[model samples]
Target: MSQTLDLSSAPAILFLFGLSGSGKSYVGNLIGELTGCYVYHADDDITDEMILALQEKRPFTNEMRDRYFPIITEKILHLRQHHNFLVVTQAVYKQRHREYLCKNIPNMEMIFIDASDAVISQRLTTRNGGITGASALALRRDFEQPDSNIKVILNEGDKSMLVTQLNNYFSSAQPEKD
Candidate 1:
């Protein structure tokens, strides 16, 4: 179950959606490396315009997520045409995202990296330079992971196990012959 995917036409989009400090970015990168696919992070604002827009919007809401999800969806679809496959990470906790992606995408799989609130808080607090009670509370409240077509990796103290599980999940997602 550890073979590379043959993605010649359009690269399948595997959206890694999980809570903050849940290692979506890190895991996405690792998966990309293992599968030889490019890892795309939608959160980065390379362009100044997008930054200004996000800033003006202020505190992120479900409403903003609703409006912004489409832009990335379209982008991923467009990117698949050129590359063999793409691995993207997003922080989707709402039900609509799960529904929309499953409906529209030809081959899409959502992997929810499950981690405890304590783990997430610890990771954030250590890495964010500084952490606040408010941010921790926000994460607890807002990390709404959709449970459709999801493969959960038990994110405990075992790093190797998590990686193995992720690799297996990708292998399963790729088409198999009888």
Candidate 2:
């Protein structure tokens, strides 16, 4: 079965959430390029303390995320005022965090980037930066899967396949005719 994304409303905020190596950043950038939307990597908002914690192989506690989420949401809100469309990439592992973002950014649309364990492992191993090893394991164990109603993009194949999937998903939408 094929998945279709309804872009009729042209969401103000496109939130892409997933595991560390699930291709959220790649897909978000592609979406931004294809749609002329601004891409904001939420990881850029991570505090130095959080970076140190990750560097030490410590998984972030809910309290840590609680302190961090507000920063991201605030920036997103501020950016939305300037840009009509925004593609945001963040590993929103907790359901409550997702809910908080939705409540704070009412026009946001959440899309989950789905990738198998083997694929994620391979990607993380080859990637130069971001979470990996024990931190990645902790994230996988702690991740709270979102509700089934949310849209998903399975990124198990090669980059071309992933791009094809995104292209089909985005190209199916009818562009506004001025």
Candidate 3:
């Protein structure tokens, strides 16, 4: 069944992902602000306690899709009922998780903010000065490059220009297909 949403109330979730400092959070927030959607970043929301619990008790795996994705899915579905859109920034590196979100999120769209590894490394250092190289290494190792369905944007060192392009790309208006 095709689901419909009230554009004035909510659009759909825009899942943003990329390496550290590739502008996922920056663009997610700007898209939410300009698009009138709620922004949800896992780095901002998932508490340390919860992460520890996941690590200590049982590891999260692809098999855990019904388990974890459901929690996220249920929450977003709840918000989708009331908001105009939900913008989520999380590192979903695997094709499977991407598929899970694609299948579950009703009308999901993805944006992969791409930057050269050097550019990301430089930006991350400037943005998160306290982060260790190990952390950046993990990010580099884990981030999966987006496939054809994802919209790609190169940083090229211009924040204002990127923001303007994004404002137009992520219009508050609904898609014609919807």
Best by TM-score: 2
CA lDDT scores, all candidates in order:
0.65, 0.83, 0.63
Instruction: Give per-model TM-scores.
Output: 0.73, 0.86, 0.70
Q: Output the number of the lDDT-best candidate.
A: 2
The collision pairs in model 2 are none
* lDDT by residue (tens digit), candidate 3, 83-109: 766788866656667777888888777
Over the stretch 19-100, how does candidate 1's per-residue lDDT look in tens digits? 7677788777866766688788877622344345334533356666667777777777787787767888866767687778
Clashing pairs in 3: 9-83, 9-84, 10-83, 10-84, 11-84
TM for candidate 1 is: 0.73
Q: Say what the RMSD of model 2 is.
A: 4.9
Ranking by TM-score: 2, 1, 3
Please identify model 1 stretches exceeding 4 Å from their true place: 1-11, 45-59, 128-133, 157-159, 172-178
Worst lDDT 10-window in candidate 1: 2-11
